[model samples]
Target: MVTTSTSVRSKSCLGPPSDMSPCGNWKVSIVTSDLPNAGTSSQIYIILYGQHRSSAPIYLYGTDRAPFQDGHEDIFTITVGDIGTLFKIRIGHTNSGLSPSWCCKEIQLWNMNSGKQFYIPVQRWMARDQEDGEICREFPILNKGQPILPVTVYEVHVATGELWNSGTVANVYISIYGEKGDTGSRQLFRSKNSFNFLRGQTDTFFLEAVHLGDLYKIIVGHDGLGPGNGWFLDDIVIRDPTTNREYAFFCHRWLDQEEDDGKIVRELYARDNSIIFARQKLEHNRKETWAAESWKFMKGNTLQFYNRLTGGFVRLHPDGTIDATGEKMDKYGFFDVIVSKGNICIFQSHEIRHLSLALDNGCVTGMASGRASTELRVVYQPNRCALLESVLVPGHTVIFDRHGKIASESAAGYADLSKEFVVFVKGMFLNNAVILLATSLCQALCLQPDGSCTGVGNQSEKSYWRVHKISSGICMFESVKNARMYLRIKDGQCDGTGTGDIDCHFKIKKNLENASVSLESTKSPGLFVGLQADGQAKPVIYTKNGNVFFYPRVIKCWHRVALLHNKMGMPSVSGALKRNR
Candidate 1:
């Protein structure tokens, strides 16, 4: 977690504080807004209150008050000792000062020991009902621990083809292999030999693997068939649900029978893996500017907009209002799943989970959240899950479904990844993940299993990947197929064989507006991750000249599409696996 304490000094007061001593082991800093109503030279004393009613409240600043500037937000931080666990703050103008009132825009507190700062904003302070003049509001509960992001699992499907059941054996068993093993290939589809059965329909069999490259070869074996004991097959089909790529094999005869006047041992062949997904990297500074504070997504960032409710999102509509109707994205439709402060934020990602945009009104309002809710059923629609804020819990933990009306009746909600990229990478310290794209020569970039790297792509099993995580949604590609090589830029392209391999590490910053990501090579300084017009999945050649800021290799990054079918994993050895194909 990046914090400001390391970079900016705490308690940067030009004038001396009225009180000379520090109170607790923590520090509190308050910054005022620069609006017109903001008091420029107002005098106000900050007081901290303890949980016990009998305990006297401590004045944050001694008798001397904090001076505020009219047009600029002012900063006032205090160091305190062990205050009670439960606390609140009271802001009041000096009794004798010229009645120029002040508004507290934002306040930040620092844990002196840990150097971690927490923030709070005061919209419009109100006075106490009692005779005493005091404006106060309790601080929000602090969020603790690292946030958890969503995890996505892709699907791999294999369908059987037409085969002539000429032999006596009616069923055949098929096993797939990326690399050969002594105990035969790993069986993905074990056949049931029933004569002339399952000849016409596409018998779909889902397979799972740690690496997709592990599936390159398929072996067809028969339990009992006469001489020439093989089945005359038509063709086999293989598809990746996530990447949306399909590999088709045209097998016209049995394993031994002639098919182009030769044998047909290979039942399936997919030739498109060589073709790399050519998405150009994005260029930020030239095209646009990003404010880090505004970009930093925090909880309680609410958006009251328009739209028709879908499963977990809203469709653009002319009529819109603030009502809890369905799920909506953060401000934009970018992040699918994000974790912040031990909370999980899930959005209705473009990639469909179970989309049904029917019978929904257009107007609705709701707060954006990164916290997951307790399980509940949809009141209006009992079949679906819910994500409403829990009224029962004082902390307001979120319920399972966004559209769910009743809190106690929905299924438990979980986070799902929205955008995904197939990448090859390895970790770099603060620089982030290193990529494994092609070099000027166009060879595949890779990381050797021995902690080294190469710039060649022929090692299919070692060079492919599916990247889903990054600090700012700007993820780098790593070779899961290869020995886990991270991609980087050497000169213009990354050379896995470079002297300081870490130098090739790059930070991909996503442009949520255009739905694109730009790669800034940390080593090359200003140079971005560029692509050669003719270089699709070939040798990476040359980058034109001195770092062109505007021309820093900009290309459209990822495309949002519905994953027709996913959820690929190891098949269980239970009754579910034994069901008829």
Candidate 2:
């Protein structure tokens, strides 16, 4: 927790910290976008902010090898003091190099003092000619928010048949489709295969796209223009970098103008369950190998079990209850692997009670005194679980149905939005305001002396909003400090009303990739609360207005509050571990 003091300094806390001032060491990791020529040679500077104080703009420098290069992650550490509860930061570069623009993918900051990490997704370009033409950007910390859909870099390996005239130079194009979406047709312009596609050769190319979840099939073809465009593709294997899962599409048939089906394009489906069974067999073998060496480093050492299916940490409670809902490494989230007399391994929580985790009748729970389940597998390095690389605050699974109704993971014994969440609003004129409500007459909901709403620079009791989730994804913003006020849209106009009626209800559709959110009026389907030219909230036609998007960045303290609630609800266990069983 960041300490708040009456006196704060607005300066950089460089060098070592003294005993007089409170200091925090932050490890900042940044990833540049993979777009062509997205790197920047200009000097970058960042200013950190806490609840109150702000840090001086510190120049960011990297080794002479290369910094801010395309598709690369760079790490740096800085020491600062007096800034409490880091909330926001301003990052930009001095436009002075040959290619000064930069497309940043995201940033991760770790506080050594709190052992807490924050992720800031910035899939935007900071350039003079790019979208909105804004160089500097401010992003608040994301805590207990929607999971950002990762941009997965897929490794596409195309294998040519080991037969005559099996290679094609007619500009082969490929497209992959999965459950969530599809990557548009892309040409195999560049390949790791030296001479591109050739007979009996395996050419590898990289394709970057939004994660498509479970791949189903792929379309591969050639232009069929060259003299010998006939090609016999043996198979195509694609590896998703995010999950390390590979999908194989077999195609033993020839894709030629006058061969087989005489087609230039062919669709191939993913292999059936045999491959999955084989992979599972391999995974079991690997786990057994690890169990063989478990005696060396498994006994009496604190560790956490990561669920392979759901990206969550396994947590055991003091009262012999367990769940797989933890998102960080904490006291309750740690456990000891107890190897008994018969070489059987038991999972014991790192608590005074020493509860054992076990599975019984398809349910996973912690028992005070019973036979622990040895069915638990140890994946030393689970796919995408890079240990604190992208750890987020623990949050309940939230899903939006096709009808825009929100659904919580309640079947798994998880609660929905039960607590008041704090968010800083961005987009339009109310750029960094804490209050999301604004009157059609006023820019923001500022209570004046006359008891009327007006626009003001200073925030008051009326500025704070409490997200009151009435239904799954449907919520009404109520004033936190002043309970009488609720953000309402009446007759297609935005305003604050004392009455919390149906007009206040809004259907929230949050983007899985970033903090951008859209609010639609439940009463008026196509009517949305969009921003006017001056940044005031207004009800605009959802189809006509593009400014209906807004970013609500969750504050870090909310994570602490959520963590506390999670700790208090330790008596109940989660059914998420059933997949492992």
Q: Considering every candidate listed, which one attains the maximal lDDT?
A: 2
lDDT of 1 by residue, 1-581 (tens): 11122112123222334443333444555555565655533345544433332112323332234445343333434443334442344444443345355556766666555565666556543222221222333343244622121111223333332222222233355544433111122222323333232433344544432223334545554443344444445445556454565544444344534223344345454444433211111122112222111122232222121211213333322222222233334333222223323222232222332221111221122323322231111111111112222322332332223442212222434432111111111121112222223231123334555544443233244544334344553444555544334555664444333333555455654332222235576555566654332122212322333111110110111211111112244343232436755
lDDT string for model 2 (1-581, tens) is: 11111122225765454543477777788889999988898887777767656677777777545588899887777776668887667688887789999999998888878888989888889887786455666665666864435556789989886434567778888988887545656667577656767766899887765576899999999898776778878788898888778888877668988667899899999863547745754565446433322332244444554443333445666765555556554567666656534334455676644476555433455665435342233332211121111011222222212222222334333332111111112111221123343221112344333333333212335455666667667877665656667766786567666377999888887432222367788988878776553334567776423356544422212333344457787422222334457
TM for every model, in the order presented, reads: 0.21, 0.26
**Quick one: RMSD of model 2?**
29.1
Tell me the lDDT of model 2 at 250: 72
Which parts of model 1 are misplaced by more than 4 Å?
Answer: 1-265, 268-445, 449-488, 491-493, 497-502, 505-581
Off by over 4 Å in 2: 1-147, 272-581
Overall lDDT per candidate, in order of appearance: 0.34, 0.59
